[model samples]
Target: MNQAPLPSYAPLAEVVRSGMREGVHYGAVVGLSAEGEVAYARGPVHDAMFPRSSAKPFQALAALRAGAPLEGTSLAIAAGSHGGEDFHAAETERILAAAGLTAEALRCPPAVPGGAAARKAFLAAGRSPERRYMNCSGKHAGMLAACVAQGWSTDDYLDPEHPLQVLVREATEDMCGERIAHTAVDGCGAPQLAVSLVGLARGIQGMRLSPEGSSERTIIEAMSAHPEYVSGTDRIDTELMTRMPGLVSKIGADGVLVLNVPTGETVAVKISDGDAEERARVLVGLTALRGLGVDVAPVKEHLTTPIQGGGRTVGEVRGL
Candidate 1:
C-alpha cells in the first residue's frame, strides 16, 4: 500500500455571501484517477471515509455475484438510491415478489418517496411511509433475493454476519483493493464499510473496467442504461449520467461524489463541511475533469449555481 502522510485540504470552491468581497463557505477536493492510476491527488487520500449510498453499486454487484436473479431496471435499482416514484416502488415490489418475499421483508426504515411530486401524491392518498418507498428498498430486495438463492436465512439478512452481508464485504474488498478499516450501521440499516478515498476510487475504476458479461460489468451497464432508476428525474446522478455518455457517477450523503469517465478517469471528492449547497460538489468534480482536458461544457451549466439576493441574481458559486 502506498500510504502517505495526511495533508491539509485545499480550497476547491468558495461560496460568497451576497456582495461580499470574501468567501463565506470553502470546500476541499482530494484525488483524481485516470488510466488505472491516481494521476492527481491532494489532501489525505488514505483516510478512512464512508462512501455512503455511493457504495450501492458494489453492494448490488455482490448480490448479483451471489446469484441474485436481477437484470435491467431491477439491476439498476439494486445499485441505486431511487427517488421512490411510483415506478420505483412498484419495481421494488416486483423484485421482492420474484424472491418469494414481500416489502415487509425489507429491513430499511419506512420513508416517504424522495420525489416531490410522488410524495405529494402519496400524502394526498392518505398513505403512510412504507418500506417499499424507502430509497434503499431495491438494494434490500436484492439482498433478500441473494439470500433466497443461496439458501441463506432471510430473517437476519441485514446483520453483518449474514451470508449476504459477508458477500458484500468480500466484494467491497475485492473492488477497492483494500481491507475495510471499519464497519458501521448505515442510515438505511445496512453495514457500511470505511475505506480510504483512494480505495474508493480504485473500487469504482475496477467496476468500470470489469470484463464483458461479468456481474460487475452488468452492474455498470445497468446503471449507465437506466440512469433514471439509479436516482430519478432531475437528480444529479441521473442528469449527469444522462448527459454524459459512458460516464458512471454516484453521490453519497454528506457531500461525497464519485465519477468514472469513459476514458478511464475516476474522480472522488468530499466536502469538509458536508454540504452541497450551490452545487459545489458537482462543480468541483467538473473542474477536476476539466483540468484533465475532459470536455465538461455540456454539463457545466447544470452544475453551476447563481448566487441570489432577494430573488435577484447576484454573484455565482463556481469552481476554483
Candidate 2:
C-alpha cells in the first residue's frame, strides 16, 4: 500500500459552525490513496454507525459474486435505487420478471421515492405500500435472484450469516482492508457493517481494482454508468457522479457519503451528531475532496449549497 500525506482538520465544532452558526455535527471523513491506504482521516466520534444506502454497491457486488445474472439496467437497478419514478418502477418490475421473481420477494421497507411527483402518483394509485416501492427493492430483488441462481436459501438472505451475506462480508472486509468490528440493522432492515473511515475508503478502492469479471468491478461500472439511477435528479450523489469524471458516489441516510474517484482515491464521510441542518458531513467530504485536488465544484454547488426561491442561496456549507 502506498502511504499518502494525512491532513489535520479543525474540530467538528469549528467545521460544524459556519458563518451562520448553529447546529451540531458528529461523523468522520477518511480518504484513501489509489493503493488502498488511508491518506487522511478524522471523526468527532466513531463506532459502528449504520452506513445505510452507502453500502449498496458492496452488497450488490455480493449478490453478483453469489452468481446473479445481471444486465445493463438490471445491473444498474441492482446498484441503483430507483426514485420510484414510473420509469424506475417499470424497470424494477421488468427486472423482477426477467428473474422470475416478484415484488413479494423484496424485503426493503415501504416508502415513497424522493420525488414529489412520484410520491403523489404512488398515493394517487391507492395501491398498498409494498417492498416494490421501497428504494431498496431493487437490491432486495437482486439478492433473491442471486439466491435462486446459486441455489442458496432465500429464507434469511438478509441475515449476516447467510451465504450471500457471508460473501458480501468477505468482500466488504477485503475491500476495507480490515475486519468488520461492528454490525447494525440498516434502514432497509438488512445487516449493515461499519468499518473505519479508512477501511471504507479502501473497500471502495478495492472495487475499482477488482477485475472486470469480478462482481465488485461490475457494480462500480454499473453505478458509474447510471449515476442518475443510483440517485435521483438533483440528488447530491447523482449529481456528483454525473458531473465528475470517473467518480461513483453513494450517500446514506444520516449524513454519510462515500465516493470512489477515478484517480483511485476513495473517501468516506460521516457526521457524528447527524444534524440534518448543515449537511455537515457532505460539506466536509467535498472540502476534503477538493483539498486533495479533486474537481468537485459541480458537486459542491449542487450538494453543499441549498438554494431558496428564485435561486437565492439561503444557506451554504462551510468546512475544511
Candidate 3:
C-alpha cells in the first residue's frame, strides 16, 4: 500500500554549461507522504536497485538485534560511511577492541583515509593503507562485535551464508517490506540486496516514524544525535543532519541517497548516469525534498556541484 506504481527511467537532472545543456542525468526517485503512501514517483520505482550504503541503518539494527550493544557514536558509526578522519579511525579501533579483536580481523581491503586531508596527513605520518581506514570498517567492526556477542564465527562474517549476514538479510527484507530480487557482494564485501526506490523510501520513512524504543527508532535517533559519527566532520550526511533538525539522511555509493524529514516525508533517489558525480545526487534529492514540502534553500547553496570550463566555474547540475 505504500508504493505507487510508476513508469520507466526519467531525466532527473541536467548538466548546464554557459546557459546550454551539456547532458542529462537520468534516474529514479520516489517520495513517501507523512501518512506512508507514495506521494510521487518518477522513473522505475517498481524495479529492483541496489541501495548500497543507504542500507546501513538496517544493518546497524541487525547488529543491535544480535546484541552488539551499540549506542551514540558507536551506533552512528556502525550505520555510517565515515570519512577516514583520525577521530573516525579511533572510534573504529574502539569498536574492534570492545570485542577483543584487532584491525587484523577486518576482512575489508586496505585503503588510505577517505578524506583528502586525512589521507595526506596519514601518508605523511608514514602510515600505509589500512583496513580501518576503509569507510566501511565501522560497519564491519560492528558486525564483528555482534558475531562475538552471538558466538558466530568471525572469520567468514562477510559471507552471505554466515549467521550474521542471515540476520542482515532478514533485517533488510523486513525493512524494505519485500523479498530481495538479487543478492550481490558490495564494494566492501558485504551482501547488497536489491529493492525498488519506492520500497527504499517507504522503509526509511517507516523506520524514521517508528515508535520510541524500537530498533528502527534507535537507529534514527542515534544517527540524528551523532551525525558527525554517522559520517564525519563537514560531510553531507553530517552537514544535512546538523543544519536541519530531525532529518535522517545518508548517501550511498553509486549515486544512491535517502532522506527522511522529521515530518515523515522520505525520498529515495538513484542517479542513473554512470558519469554523474556525487554532487549531482544531493541536488536531485533536494529537489525531491522540496517537492515533498521541505524548504531546501537552507542547504541547497553549495550542495550542487559546479561545472568547470577554462578553469572557471561555468555551470551546474540541477534536478529536473
TM-score of each: 0.93, 0.86, 0.95
Tell how far residue 292 is off in model 1, in angstroms: 2.4
The alpha-carbon lDDT assigned to residue 280 of candidate 3 equals: 72
Per residue, candidate 3 scores C-alpha lDDT tens digits across 1-320 of 57644336789888899999998888888888899888778888879988999999888988999999788898899999998998888898999999999999999889998766787889999988889989999999999999999999999999999999999889888988998888999999999988888888888888888899988988999899998888877578889888887888899988899999888999998887633357677877888888888887778774467889999999987777
Candidate 3: 10-residue stretch with minimal lDDT = 1-10
Question: Model 2 — which ten-residue stretch has the worst lDDT?
Answer: 9-18
Highest-scoring model, lDDT: 3
lDDT of each: 0.82, 0.71, 0.87
lDDT of 1 by residue, 113-172 (tens): 987788888899999989989999999999999999999999899999998899999999
lDDT for model 2, please: 0.71
Clashes of each: 0, 7, 0
lDDT of 1: 0.82
Instruction: Give residue 133's lDDT in candidate 1 (0 to 100).
Output: 90
**What ordering of candidates by lDDT runs from best to worst?**
3, 1, 2
- Runs of candidate 3 with Cα error greater than 4 angstroms are 1-7, 274-276, 302-304
In Å, residue 149's CA in model 3 sits off its true spot by: 0.8
TM-score of 3: 0.95
